[model samples]
Target chain A: MTSILEVNNLTKTYDQFSLDRLSFSLQKGCITGFIGVNGAGKTTTIKSILGLINPEAGSIRFDGMEMNRQEKQIKNRIGFVLDEGYFYGMLTVKEMKNVIAPAYSSWDEQTFSNWIGRFGLNPNQKIASLSTGMRMKFAVALALSHHADLLIMDEPTSGLDPMMRSELMAILLDFMKEEGKSVFFSTHITSDLDKVADMLILIDGGKILLNEEKDTLLDNHARIKGDSRWINERTRPLFLTLRETPYGFEGLTHQKEALRQEMPDAVFERPTIEDIMLAYVGGAEIAH
Target chain B: MLINLVIKDFMLMKKYLLFLVLFALAAPIVIASQTKDDSLLFLMPFYLIMITEIATYLQVSKFESISRGAAFICATPYTRRTFIEAKYLFVFVTFVGILFAQIVASFLLPSLKTGLNLNAVGAAFLMVSLLFGVLIPCQIKFGFDVVRWIFFGLAFLIPFSLGPILRWYQSLGIHFSFSLPVSQTGQILLMYVFAVVITFVSMYASIKIYEKKDL
Candidate 1:
């Protein structure tokens, strides 16, 4: 599959933190879930891709074009949905649409209006009055209306309730119905990705810990449950993570069969994306 | 794209448009009624232009503060340079709009017409342009918060200190005078040329600053 975006050796630094030579690629026409904990540099990476922030080193290429050389053209084909809608509070939805519509060369008035209506947004209502969910809906409407080939959303579903998140996922799925369109959705909600994401990328501490096909990532890892005594120096390295709770001990591993052979009484089950992610990040936090 | 951004700013300013128009008309009338010299009323347009310019500059920051609109705009296809260009255009267009209003209102209100002087307006234009020329880039580079302090000095402290400076000069018994060596038209033309040059310089600087900004 062709990559829609190729980020190579990306680096950015701040007083408090730094993104150290991070790298990843988003495949064309697929939903890539960018899963990371809070302050894992997800937003920073997205911002850098959109040229909102400059990186000290590395290159970002979109559709085989270097982003720095053709930022305007690259951006024209991208629709970005920030966590919160950014619009003038004083203007009504209709006025706001008029203001933003001209920025995109492929802006479709009918599409904009249709999405606005479908989202149940009042054209005459002020943007400031909209709730968080409504604001996100408005942002999605704008993104879809622009005829963009790529939608890069930063923590788009962070604060949303389950119902609202599902509704957003539906809109995104509908958007991807057209070929050559893809979505880079960053969120902490792994369950949402389990439903729709074809590829998974897990970032922690400004570094990519895992990047693979969603099914492959799940298939390679298993959740293992057994007595706390089963965790020993000899077997501990075999488990991706070995943690003990009051009830017993459980861990996750890619070599589930090998570990099963060693601990015949242990229970081994298929791992979810969340389980794999937690095993990697949750273990690191506790170890530190 | 730039036009769309400019329109958005205009729509944002729509709420204050009517109030500004009324103020522009009523301000000259009130000032002229107090002054014996009708020619002094020519300052009305200049006064209106200055006050409105400052007010509008102040309002520019409000657009981005709402919903983090700056970030939103940055996320769009428009470049940072384009965003800054739209702002400069917005300032220029708004100035032109006010200038047109002042001229039209002057025709309708006889007192303003009696006081109108093309050279004076032209001079006011130069000063206004120079003020914003310095301000726009600073606002773009450091953002509204840091620039607001600079704006406070420009808007209030400098003007307020002038009175004390003049008193101190009087106490020292010092005097200064200067006469224009050129005709009224020549002076007006010179001011316009200088204003245009300053505006471009400011714009270039703003674009450079904004391009490096990590918004």
Candidate 2:
């Protein structure tokens, strides 16, 4: 697979926090789920790729085009869905569409209409009147209508209801069925990605801890639960994170089979994306 | 893209359109009732120009900041240059539109015609251009808070300090004459060229500042 987006050593510093030399790549025709704790630099990375914030150092290449050099053309082929609605609330849906349609060369009115109709969004309704879910749907519809090859979303499903979230997942799945399309969305909701994302990236403390195919990442990591005695000084390093209770212990590890051979009585559970993320991010808190 | 951006601004200003119409109609009546000299009537629109220009700036600046519309525009396929160009061009269009409306109104109402006195018109144009030259860059670079303070400072401070400053200057034996040389079409043309230069310079500075701004 070829990378549609590649970010290398991207850095941006602020007084309180910094995005440290972040690097990641999104392959063509795959959904890469960007999972991170709050303030883990997901948005910063996304902004750097989009050139919203100029990085202090490093480079971003979209489809082999340098982002800073070919910004306008690269951006035309990429769709962005922001966490919050960035459109003017005073504008009706139709007016907002009119404002945005001219910006993209491949804007499709028929596709836009179909998405709007599917979302049950009234074109005449002022954007401020829509609920958060509806507004997100509208944003997604707008992004997909422009014949964009890559869709980069920042926590678009953060506050959505289950039904809306499921519908959005379905829409993304449908969008990916077409050739040469890819998606990169940052989200705290791992369950949403568990059902949809092909690749999973876990970030913590401004660093990437894991980037692997979702199935592979899940298959490799395991949650081990058993008596606290199973966690000894020699075996401690094997657990990515471990928590002990009065009666037992539970922990996550990547060397599941090796650890299982050592502690034959221990129960090993398949780790979810959430488990993997927590092991990386909640390492300090859960460490024995 | 620039045209669409301007159109978006116009759409956002939809509510203000009715007020503009009312002002257009009521301006003539107010000026007619307040002044006996018809030549001075053109000055009403000049004042209106100042007020409307400031109002438009405040409105759009407030909207952009509040809606976080700059984030949207920045994320889109637009270049910072194009965004700034749309804004500068939008101001030019608004200035022309209001000026044209006033001039047309003057023609329809014979008393309001000032017979194309280049001096007054040229001075008004220069003043508005300078005002925007200072204001737009400040607003674009420093944001609404700084712009608001600068506006209030100028509004209150200038008039309040005028008498004292003049007196202080007089005490220093600094005497100046308030006079104008005989005007010609060439001088009028030169003033316009100067105004255009100032506006464009300000626009270029604004674009540079906005380009580096980490919005």
Candidate 3:
């Protein structure tokens, strides 16, 4: 599959934190989930991609065009939904649209109106009056109305209830039905990605820990539960993370087949995305 | 694209603009009737124009900061250069519009007609342009929050210090006087040219400052 967005050696630094040569890409027509803990450079990376912040070093290319060299043209084809809705709160919905629509050459009023209706948004209502879910929906509607080929959303699901999250997921799934469309969704909520994300990129401490297909990643890692006696020095190195109780021990490992041969009584279960994330992030913390 | 950004600023400030217009039309009439001072009549309209310009400038800046609207706008197809250009253009256009409105209103009232001289127009234009020329670059460098406090401080400090400063100048035993070797029209033209230069320089500085700023 062709890549829609690519970042190579993307680096940014603050006094306290930095994005240390982080890199990732999104395949065309795929939903890529970007998962990281708070203050883990998720917003920094997204801002770099969108040209909201200047990176110390890196190249961000969207659809084969370099972002810095062709910023206006590149931005015209990209849409973004920030964690918080950064809209003119004083303007009514239609009035705000009037300001924004002229900025995009491909804005479709009919499509925007359709989305407004579908989302049950009143055009005359002030933007500040809308609820969080409604604000996010309005943002998505604006993104879609501009015929954007790629959507870069920064924690679009944060602070939303489960039902709103589900609705947003449905919108993303529906948006993906079109050809050559892509989404780069950043959030710590891994459950939302389980339902819709085709690819997952996990980051921690300004570094990318894992980038793989969701199914392939899930298929390769498993949770192993067995007696603590089986966890010798040799076997201990095999598990990515281990937890012990008075009864049995539970651990996470990617070497499931190797572990099974050694400990035949061990139970193997499919691990959720959250479990995998914790194993990677928590294990890294333990190592540090 | 630049026009769209300017229009957006106008839309954001529409309510404030309405209030400013009402004040511009009604304030002078009331001040002239109450004070019965012709000089006050002249100063009030120009003062109102300056206040309108400053209020609009500060309102847009504050709104953008509070709403994070700058980040949102930069995310659009508009470039940072375009955004800066739009702001300068928006302020310039607004200044001219209010000045024209004040001029038209002056013709209707005989009491204010004497104040509408070429020197008055030139002085008002030069003062406002120079003030914004310095202010816009300061805003770009320090951010609106810091610039706002600075502005408020200067507003209070200048009037309060003027008397003492003049006394201190007199204590120096220095007298200042000047006569330019030019016609009144030529002098006014020079003032206009200087204002334009200051404005462009300020705009260039603002664009340079904003281009590298992390939103």
Poorest stretch of ten by lDDT in candidate 2 chain A:
A45-54
lDDT of residue A23 for candidate 3:
80
TM-score of chain B of each: 0.87, 0.85, 0.90
Candidate 1: Cα lDDT at A127: 87
Q: Write the residue-wise lDDT of candidate 1 on B1-215 in tens digits.
A: 78888887777778887887777667776776688785577667777788887788677676565446766777777778788888888888877877777667766666677646667777777888888898888788677878777777777877789999989989998778887999867878999999989999999999888878787
Ten-residue stretch with the least lDDT total in model 1 chain B: B60-69
**Please, what are the lDDT tens digits per residue for candidate 2 over residues A1-288?**
999999889888988788888888999999999999889988888877776787899899999999878988998999889898788998899999998888888999999999999999999999999999999999998899999999999999999999999999998999999999999989988889989999998887678888999999999989989998777887788899998889999989999888988899999998888989988888767875
Q: Please list the C-alpha lDDT of all candidates, in the order they appear.
A: 0.84, 0.85, 0.87
**Candidate 2 clash pair list:** none
Candidate 3 residue spans exceeding 4 A from truth = A284-288, B33-45, B167-183
Give a tens-digit lDDT track for model 1, residues A1-288.
Answer: 999999999999999888999999999999999998889889999999988888999999999999989888898899988876667777888887787777788899999889888889999999889888888888888888878999999888878889999999998899999999999999887888998999999998899999999998888888889887877777788877777888888788888778888899998888888888887788655422
**Per-residue lDDT of model 3, residues A212-288, tens digit only:** 99999999999999998998877888888898778989888899999999999999999999989999989755422
